[model samples]
Target: MPITEILSYGFMQRALIAGTLVAVLCAILGVFLVLRRLSLIGDGLAHVTFGSVAVLLLTRVGAQSVSLAAIPLVMLASLGILRLTDKARIYGDTAIGIVSSLGIASGVVLASVAGGFNVDLFSYLFGSILAISPMETWIAAALFLIVLVAIALYYHDLFAIIFDEELARSSGIRVAAINRLLVLLTALTVVLAMKVMGIMLISALLIFPAVTALQVARGFRSTIVIAAVCAVVSVVGGIFVSFVANLPTGGVIVLVNAVLFVAAYAFRRCKE
Candidate 1:
């Protein structure tokens, strides 16, 4: 199928729009998360989302309602994780590991009690981009705008925080509050992107692009720009290729990013 023919379909258009927004959201926030050594937070929150979605599904809530409900629940979980790491004796990675395990176990228990996995649950677990509705597209657009505005407003503070947490705190940047805000943004991004990448592979979107860019880019701003470009290209190219090949959209997109990361790694190695 030609590009024009693909865009001619409404579902394809919605998928592209939503995928692009999700790519941007993941790439931009992912940079800071990588710098802050909080990449696992994405994985942890994704697991939390999986469990939350399962609980909602078990209760017979609509998918859209489950999605909406997952946002606050995931954010609260993100905050709780942060608190555990900061206030308690546990380390960050350990806290994330514990929560991740709990989330997966909860999801499994809920799914088993709900009569095992169904198509609807499978879609959330592995994604169903081609099935996205117009309302989901609108929601994604709104989320994109929110992410863009929030990043724009806090760009400098985030930059400072990313570079040196103690220095940022010394400079009155409210490091604790900003860190929580970053986690909150990440939780929102995870939930929204889960619609495209699913719970199993969503963390790749949050980690791969930024890591790929770091392999090549020399400066922070350049790295961010490159990561966003890599992310958007991966999404658009994956969607197109998946349509032509009849492959899984989420899997194809993550594979595309993986390829990009490998290429970037090779390029960096060659340069060195």
Candidate 2:
């Protein structure tokens, strides 16, 4: 079908909206994830969404509704991992690594239980961004607004903790509560984006644009702003490429981001 024919379908419009919203939020949450040095966790949780999708499928529930319902469960499961790790001696990436393994393991079991060969499983694993619907768009939009408000309300504390946890604690930043909120936000973003990039490439959607921004950004605000722009461009460009090349949108989006980074790096060198 031609692009015009494709646009005639409601799914495509919803997909564009969903992709744009997820890209924006991922770009935002990713800054903190990168700052916290837990980029792998972002990837891991995304894969975890895969498993959760699998489990939800086993229940024979609807795919569109499953995501909204799964958001809280996924958030709780992620938070549970954090709390468990916090109770023990491990901190930082090590803890995330442990939880990631557990989440993936659980997801596999759930997917298997749902059916040994649900074709939808493949789509969930790799993503089917073109199939996004109105509900998914709304979900992403609402979550974006919520995250925006939360960040605004706690900007200073979040910055303090991101910059230095000890200093944040010394300044009475409520580190634990803040950390939980961040994890929850991360999980929420993952759920919304899991549809577009799927479990496999969602983390790239989160991290790469922020990295692209870091190369040219002078400060935190500038970095994130640039990243958001880069992210939107990557998503829109990748989706277009995916439509034309018949490839996965998630992978293409990440590739575009990588290309941008290389371009930025070369351009900076030329100027220097």
Candidate 3:
């Protein structure tokens, strides 16, 4: 089928728009996340998002409520977890590992107890790029706006704080506050993308493109710009590939990102 044919369907169109918006937002967030060495944080949040979705399923929250109510709660919880980790002087790495296991366990147990919610549990697990709703499309757009503003307003502070939180705090940056904001934004973007990207591998969408950009970028500004562009390309390409190949949309998108990262890393390694 012609690429145009994919966009002709209402669902396909919605998916495409949703994917585009999410691809951009996730890429930008991933830039800072990577710079801050918070890659595992993305993975943990992904699991938490899955757990939250499981709750929505168990609670019999209407489909619309999943992204709205559950997502924020998950984000807030993630922020709180981070704070607890920070304040307790627990290593973030260990905390992420602990949190990830608990979050994913919650999802699985809830799934089992409910005797399973939606057969579309597979879709939530791996993402179904073809099933985006119009409401999801709007939500993604609004989130992108918010994320972009946050990035612009806090760019220098974030970069500094990510490099050295104690130093940034000493220099008058609210490192703790900024970290909270970043985690919340990350959680929000992850939720928005969960429909198209799926919880099972949504972290790939957040990390891979930013990773690819990081390989070639000389500085933060260039990295963010390149990551955003690469993300758009990956989403559009992955959607089309999955459509044509009849692959799992989330897996296909993540596979594409994986291939690109490997290729980029190889090229950079050879150059160095």
Candidate 4:
């Protein structure tokens, strides 16, 4: 479809706006998470998102309300997961695996007990850009702004924590508080992104763009810029391609990001 044709529909316009915001949020949060080797944090939180959303769906709650409700639930889960990883004597990935499995199992049971997959459930799992509404677009915009401002305000502290937690602690940066703040942001970003990337694939959005950027960028600032650019392009291109092909939007977006990562890898290899 032509640009004009795509913009003619209200849903498309809303989806594009929401998707772009989600892309930026995920990309920015992703850089630090990837650097900290905490990429699975997105996956674990997404599973919690899936389970919580399923429970909300079973209760007949509205979509926007469900999204909002998931935020606190996800934040609590994130905190618990972080605490476990930090002090429970368990491997971080092991903690993530346990929580991820529990969340997935709970989601499956909720769906079955609620009489199986409906359009709403399917939409949460796979995503449907055509189903986004104006309200969702607004919410996405607000979250985007919050994420942007928060990241900008704490850029130096976050940078310190990301590279060396002990050094940051010794520097009196309150590493624990910074870690909690980062996890909270990750939880929020995971929930917001689920609408665009789906629970099953949200981690890809949170990791791929940053990793791709890292392949070529020489510095932190350059990596973030490249990641944000790649993320926006992937989201826009995925929406367009999905619209044209009538494919699943989340999967298509992840695929686009994968292709970008591959291209980046090839470019880096050639340069070397």
lDDT of each: 0.90, 0.81, 0.82, 0.89
Q: Estimate each model's TM-score.
A: 0.97, 0.93, 0.94, 0.97
State, as a TM-score between 0 and 1, how close model 2 is to the true structure.
Answer: 0.93
Query: Model 4: runs farther than 4 Å from truth?
Result: none
Clashing pairs in 4: none
Backbone clashes in each candidate structure, one number apiece?
0, 2, 0, 0
Arranged by TM-score, best first: 1, 4, 3, 2
Where is model 1 more than 4 Å wrong at Cα?
A: none
The CA lDDT at 124 in model 3 is: 72
Per residue, candidate 1 scores C-alpha lDDT tens digits across 35-77 of 9998989999999998999898988888776777889988998
Superposition TM-score, candidate 4 onto the true structure? 0.97
Residue pairs with colliding backbones in model 2 are 51-107, 58-114
C-alpha lDDT of residue 83 in model 2:
81
* Candidate that would win on lDDT: 1
List the pairs of residues colliding in candidate 1.
none
**Winner on TM-score (3 vs 4):** 4
